[model samples]
Target: MLTSAWLDGLSLGDPIAADPLEGGYASRTFRVRTALGGSVVVKTQDNLPENLYALEADGLDALRAPGGFAVPEVLRVTPSYIVLSDLGTSEPSPTYREDAGRALALQHQQTADKFGYHVDNYLGTLPQRNPWTGDGHTFFAEHRLLRYLEEPNCHNQLPADDRRRLERIAGNLVNLVPVQPPSLLHGDLWHGNLLPAPNGGPAMIDPAVHYGWPEADLATLLIYGRLSDTFFDAYEEVHPPSPGWRARLPLLHLRELLCITAHWPDRAETVQEIHTILEQFD
Candidate 1:
């Protein structure tokens, strides 16, 4: 429950109203109206990990550093809640997708010598381990794919044979994925994370930022089947994808499917999806 005292503590003006928002898996989100005659978005949760909100604020800053797309301005961030400047959104349009694609390509141009971030961050509520690794495939295998196997939901839900199959795929990742530079990845790129900016362009929110293979971000966007071909076309204009990337798409998305399965052990469809992908490689 949001109270006027909490808003007063932040000195963000008096709280007029706080309307509940949908689609927040990690926190309770609200579009808060203030007596200052402006509104902001507030995301709050109790007993969060020590640095969750702080790390998220850092990610938004890092994303903005590339000057590629628009990210919300972090007004105030505490362990329990964060206040951000409201960027009203609209429905997705072909032009918005095209703009977003080009923007994302430009963002990916900011590369690093190693594949990982300086510090680890969260993907949803799960800790995403990102130790600096020289090899891309090794980083993706160890940090992105295999790391989730330790979770109770992931370990218990998968049978012995299925686990072995996943391990086999991880071992063969070097052969399956292409050699690519360590590009800045949105880490959790999907349609839901991208809001339709009021400026008739794309605005990114809720990012899990890192430096890794750009194809991973592309794979995430493709898996949702929401964005159209126009986005890819625009992206290619700025930065073309590596050869054989299409064939590796399913394999690249394995990390996300694994993460979802961990968060929702009861979602049988996610388990089936994992099997479906594993079957493709066998």
Candidate 2:
């Protein structure tokens, strides 16, 4: 429970109210209102990796760095908690989706020399390793795809034959995926992370940011069936996708499916989805 005293300790001021927010599977989130009439979103986790919030703050900074998307302002951060200026969410309009698409494409235009981040970051509670590498294929295969196989949950969920198939697919990334510069990705740009800002533009939250193949972000949005053609059309107006990009959705989506399996070993459906992708590429 949050109290005014706690807010005082953080020097945020006396909170007149704290309202719980939904869709927080990994942490407790609240929209806190202070006596000063300022509202901020507070996210807290009792047990987390030592630097999770700090890393998250870094990611938010990276996203904001590109000046492409509207991300929350990181007002304060501690090991267990983070306070961000509330961007405020609403039901998204078609115009908002289009704006989001354009913003994302423009964001990806800011590329890096290599395919990775300066340091590793998290995808949800899971660690995402990002060792800087020149070859995109090697980076995606080793870091994004195969590395999760070492997770204990994956070992339990995937059979030996399925594991071998995944290896073959990873080995063939060079032949499958088109070469693209290391574009900055929101890294986790699904519908849930995209919000309609009060000013009627797209605001993003909960990023797993890195420099990677831009298709990975598009695939994440398409796989969830939340984004519409308006978004893609607007995106293409800014930055056109590579040829055969649509055909690569299943392949790019393997990263998210594998992560899901690692997070929830009991989710047989996610495992089956992995098998489907492997059968297509392996």
Candidate 3:
């Protein structure tokens, strides 16, 4: 049995079972049940310079405040563990997918003034290396995506043509648009990180929380195959993607794909997918 020193305040009751939940790449997650009918999701990780659980707790609290989106209620957060409300066992509903766009608009409406967060955070256990200089293009392209591609893991995966194409795209992205005022973003809003609440609303978790362009969230959602078309429809109804947003998708996704490739070099399928997507832009 795994011990959580942070659970001292709450009555955990008799242990039922600790079943593994899928989709977290960095932290260990389990569905913990108690004999007294209480259940919660627990996430554990090694202590790092960034107290991610605490940051997540703060982010969730911000998102649950007045006029914020429906986010999970945080139960406890410590250096090694975080306990959170169990939204449920069910997968995200079509309603979630259908309404995701609108929901995101609502979430984005909850914004902050700064373009960057005060404290730096990680992306899946890896140092995200966001620029403190506050230059969005330089941060997104030069420091994040291009720097990751220079890694041997990414270099070996791309053919010469694809590398050239990626380089050109990266250069082009620098001048695409002036950075918009930063909004509070879920940071890593991929489909798997979102779950359905029992009451038919959407709940978010495992966020790489930050303040950045709203389009960054939309771009990440399009990379995975989970979001439904209804999501886009609903989103546009509330907050439409900016002009040339479609063209910028690959540029935004390049950072995420490179991050994954750097961390999970063995995932040849992911590398192949990156190649395929890059080919489309070329």
Candidate 4:
């Protein structure tokens, strides 16, 4: 097999088989199978930031710390390439969804003194700032929602009124948002990012991780589609959400929808979705 330049640099001692795998916006991915019966994923980027894979590696380590949930094991990393244990992708059963909920709730127990992450990370190609803050509303307003408003794509996509309303929403967040201490979060958890585990449970990939409200994770689940009721039932049984969480789902969802609008130009529906949410708050 003709090895790609990245595979040559990896220097894995074992001979391997490689197959192309699609689905990353910023990198080329491949699934490699070894003669020794091991499978790993390798991603290569021509202009990736030096810490991209390293940050992902750190997030995987944190998610794996709680056990039960599966996060790919890091094998090799560099600015150009990252090799990780290949998590299987299969349609999950109802039991799998329930376990995913249970495991995520257990992971959420791993908390921090404040909201935010110790290190700054990227959500796709966009920078996600995570300075520690004593309050969740301030963190969400400053980092999650308003930060994207300044982006060039954001200005181009959202009209002046939509931008102003988002600002108004941010300014009044203290009253609209409920207070909650920080919990570990898979900052991006839309359905496409979810992978079924080899053990028949859930394993997540491409985490934009932080210590934030656990409900933010739940909100992400709802935006694209919902998991089985068993998932929420199991999660609540382990770590119940605040009393009025369902009402706040749109507010939490506004962050990701705005991010999608800011990052991708042709996604008019996503831009309209952000407009709908911001107008709802008005």
Compute each candidate's TM-score over C-alphas: 0.95, 0.95, 0.84, 0.92
For residues 217-248, write the lDDT of model 2, one tens digit per residue.
99999998878899999999999998899899
Cα error, residue 99 of model 4, in Å, equals 0.6
Lowest lDDT 10-residue stretch of candidate 4: 1-10
Clashing pairs in model 4?
none
Steric clash count of candidate 1: 0
TM-score of 4: 0.92
Candidate 3 per-residue lDDT, tens place, 1-282, comes to: 456454556786754777788888768888888777878888886755447788878767756644335677788888878888888866555566665567778777766655566666778776655445455665566655677767777777767887777777677765664466566788888888777777666777877767677788888898675767888888888877677886777667777887888776586887777787777765
The 0-to-1 C-alpha lDDT of every candidate, in the order given, reads 0.87, 0.87, 0.72, 0.82
lDDT of 1 by residue, 46-127 (tens): 8788789899999998999544888999988888898888887566556787889899999999999999999999998999
Instruction: State the local distance difference test value for candidate 3.
Output: 0.72
Candidate 1 lDDT for residue 152: 89
- RMSD of each candidate relative to the true structure: 1.6, 1.7, 3.0, 2.2
**Candidate 1, clashing residue pairs?**
none
Q: What's the distance in Å from true for residue 168, model 2? A: 0.1
lDDT preference between candidates 3 and 4, better one:
4
Candidate 2 off by > 4 Å:
9-12, 65-67, 90-94
Q: What would the C-alpha RMSD of candidate 3 be, to one decimal place? A: 3.0
Off by over 4 Å in 1: 9-12, 90-94
Residue-pair clashes per prediction, in order, are 0, 0, 1, 0
